[model samples]
Target: MKSGVFFVAAAAVAWGMGGVVASVLYRISGMGPLAVSFWRAGFGVLVLVLVQLVRRRPVGPRALFPRGWVMIVIGLGLAVYQSAYYLSIAQAGVAVGTVATLGACPILVAIGARLFLGEPLTGRAVLAVGVAIAGLVMIVGGPGEVGPHPVLGIFWALVSAAGYAVVTLLTRRYADRIGSDDVGKTLASFVVATLCLLPLAAAEGLLPASNATVAFGWLVFLGIVPTAMAYTLFFNGLKTVPATTAAMLVLIEPVSALAVAVAVLGERLGLPAVAGTVMLLAAVAAMSVPVRRGSRAAVAAGAAGFDRAAPEPAVAGASEASGDPASAR
Candidate 1:
């Protein structure tokens, strides 16, 4: 349990730095969001592939392909999530975009699971969603300090949140079939995302020639550290921790991003926005707390039933696994 908590916390801290890093890249390189997304995914795949090679693991087509179309869907979802998230930051400012997207993800995922995955919408989940949405309204409607286009940014951020929710659900459902090799799954999905975004990035052109070196450095940092390493830690932790616990621990990402935005980027929030952020985070925490006794038993029964209906394992792996659906960005 301690190891699980530690790994999750470490992943959160790494992910928390992602926004700040991207913000710096935007300011320094003047690269478009799509361009940044392309490089991040591209370099991330390289990093994962290299790691797998170094570890002497299989990286062949047979090993990398996910069962059926799961990887394709996850790949497309990732492309959308990454692009929209960066665009949200570009339009709304790092602080608001990160908070809105990350803050809303768990609530969206919870609602999605209940509706499609046959998970129950417990009273706790309902309250959490309500409070979270209320908080979102406050953040969106409150004064805008992050960027000039708050509404547009919020829209994109919500899109990112939805994409992330979809990916999370699909990954969890297909995890056993996706194979036991997390690195291979991640690399394959990232490669798909990279290919999907390549054209858009090309249209925008690569990093500015003058800032090429510095920009490339930051892109590599974004890819290797936050994107690759963060997910590695997250997946490792998921081996021991319950998905619920890991989900809650990852809330640290937004808090870390918020701190960096204020301290490093000179961002500020109004009273209402601050209150809204608090409410949103509180809702996430409330929903993540483990239910006790009777409710726990009920949840266990539901899970057991769901497992019975799920397909037999297509590959060998841990039953419960978690990955940062947004590439930890």
Candidate 2:
């Protein structure tokens, strides 16, 4: 494989560590996932800002609020997506929740491609989606996820996953114009999440009840490592690859989560769950399959446009490698 593919794979590995990292923090601080997410965003921004400062790159408005209204609106979806997703994972196990969210994104991408972007739905895309839907049934809505009263937790996660799919599609569409200043977009999303959940976090008493050094340390780690470090690595990985392909690589996250759950949480997946995971993986592969021309040109174009609209130094450095990435899908 080419070196770029290696970067994508590395990204997958980095993203896979997120669940375990978050789980570890939970044990240390006992902070609610929402609070954890909020702190993660807040602290992560500090890291990113410091990096920018050390690089000596001037802070233009783009980095501060790149993409303007469009990014802010997209940020809203992201906030909703993250909030629901974390809640789902907290309520449901990692294996079930991650699959539901990541698995559902392709369908949203396809539908978005056909409608707004005017990309034709090839037979391959259609078939892949159909298989994915069948797989979704078995994994999320199928009899397997059912237990006692119901799996309302997993259901919320499914909704959140669908929402995130839309978020990714929008990012692929708009981030090009926003440029690498896309940090603003991510910040806006996290800010929205924090604000929206402020009331909830307060009500749950998960915000500031902790007084131990362990809790503080975990809070900082949650902010920097999984939330901050993950995204920097995630976007760095994106610079080296295509968005769709990047999305597919993240599928490893669920697998990683499953492994973590089995070893750490002592949870064993049911046979049906495993089968459903296999089907979902197949569906993701089909949906993420590169086009005849390459992976995804439109997505690449959008990323370019976003950079043009709001260029960043790191993104500029990535230009030589990214000018014409083989494919993001």
Candidate 3:
């Protein structure tokens, strides 16, 4: 079946809960940051495996590791992205960490695409990026959080963004060729991430006791909902949205998180948050609008690549390279 609009919306909805879900898992598991990273991936793989079986799809190793060690290369980046991102948020504080990582990712992805894929950005594109970065700044400082080491958070954020950027570039460059479907690519990332975290999770005593119902439940949700469903929606949406567009659309995640918290979870939305969210969303929307026909073509081409991996002009890419070490962009 043809997929585009539905996938994008679904991904948006699914991933909207990203922060909330991560926070929930943290609350219940009493697990350290590393453990949360490990279980999310491990359980996510398990769920995907089950989903593949239910779909009557054959699960083979063939489509999984094609293009030689490229998956591993990408996977290593994924691991770093995931771990560093979480660490950044944990050590540095979410606001500083989030902005540094997410705000910076698109810039790096654009650069990577230019260098590797021969994609170049126009003046409008550059302006769009700048607007978005400004919005990102507002968002990070919004709600007026103060800390001693904002620099640490910013440092982690940049690292996370860098790592996620690598993941996006790899996916755009190689996913269609290696995996049977985008699911295969996502699975590969999760599997590789799981392996990478096994040792750290083990060392940090991050594994759940299996008998602990609440913790296990949190772990399972981490995988099935945010991990599996989120990626699925992203891939599906990637079919319709341009890589640059999709990456920007992701800015909606933080907004969605705040809305969920305020409306559903009885959290507060301070003036800074509301203002920042508006600015950020506006920036994201502006960044996604293609002023030129070629820019529009980039979006459609990105859609085409879903059916088959075809090259598209570089506008921007949503690299999973977060300042977080654990997340795969």
Candidate 4:
């Protein structure tokens, strides 16, 4: 449980930073969302491939594409979500866009899990989600200029949220079957996603007009930190953490992202936003507390169909308990 929390929280921080960086990139590079999304995935693929080469791990199609069709769907989903999110943040202010997109995710995941996975939606989970969302409302409602086309931005945000929800559920559903080569899985998905976005990005022009070293550096940082590192950690965490809990844990993104925005983007953080941040942290902290062995939360988790201590399959030359398994398609 501790490991799961750590992974998810760390990923959320990286994602939060990435969001701010992306906004900056937009201003400097003048790149469209499609182009930016393409580069993010493209650079991420390079990093993962380098890791594979450095470790001398051969990522064959069989290992990477455990389920060919599903992997494709996951990759497409990733492309859609990433592009849509960038669009949302571009059209909506970061706070509004992030809150709308992320806030909708846990709700969607919870409903999907209940319907498809038979996971019992405990009352405690409901309360936690409600509290987290309230915090989000306060954060976005506080001092901040609303972006142009907020309604359109929100529409795109919802689309991003729905796409992400599908990807999360599919990953969780197939974690056991995908074996434990999380790195390979993430790499494969990025490869496919990059390919999917390439045509659109090319149409929009791939390279930024500015040749500034700092702009390129930011792009690299976006790929390595958020795209590669954050996702690897997130997929590993999802192997043990239930989908709903993982969704809630990611609410940390808005808090951390808003902090970065205030510091770097000159965004205002009023008292209401401060109070909301505190409230949001409390809710996430509460969610992190381990459920008692026989508690209702524990029972609900058991019903969700994953075991934290479950031994991973023998693959990728890794031991059963040595490291976390891949939860990507």
Per-prediction TM-score: 0.77, 0.67, 0.81, 0.85
Cα RMSD (angstroms) for every candidate in the order listed: 7.2, 8.9, 5.3, 8.0
C-alpha lDDT score of every prediction, in listed order: 0.65, 0.51, 0.61, 0.71
Q: At residue 245, give the lDDT of candidate 4.
A: 80
Worst 10 residues of 3 by lDDT: 312-321
- Tens digit per residue, CA lDDT, model 4, 18-57: 7667666666877755776777788888899899889888
Q: Give the lDDT of residue 135 in candidate 3.
A: 64
Better of 1 and 4 by TM-score: 4
Worst 10 residues of 2 by lDDT: 314-323
Off by over 4 Å in 2: 1-12, 58-62, 86-100, 127-159, 181-192, 207-211, 233-247, 261-289, 293-329
Give the runs in model 3 whose Cα sits over 4 Å from its true position.
1-9, 142-153, 208-211, 290-329
**lDDT of model 4, residue 47:** 92
**Residue-level lDDT for 8 in candidate 2:** 44
Number of the top lDDT candidate: 4
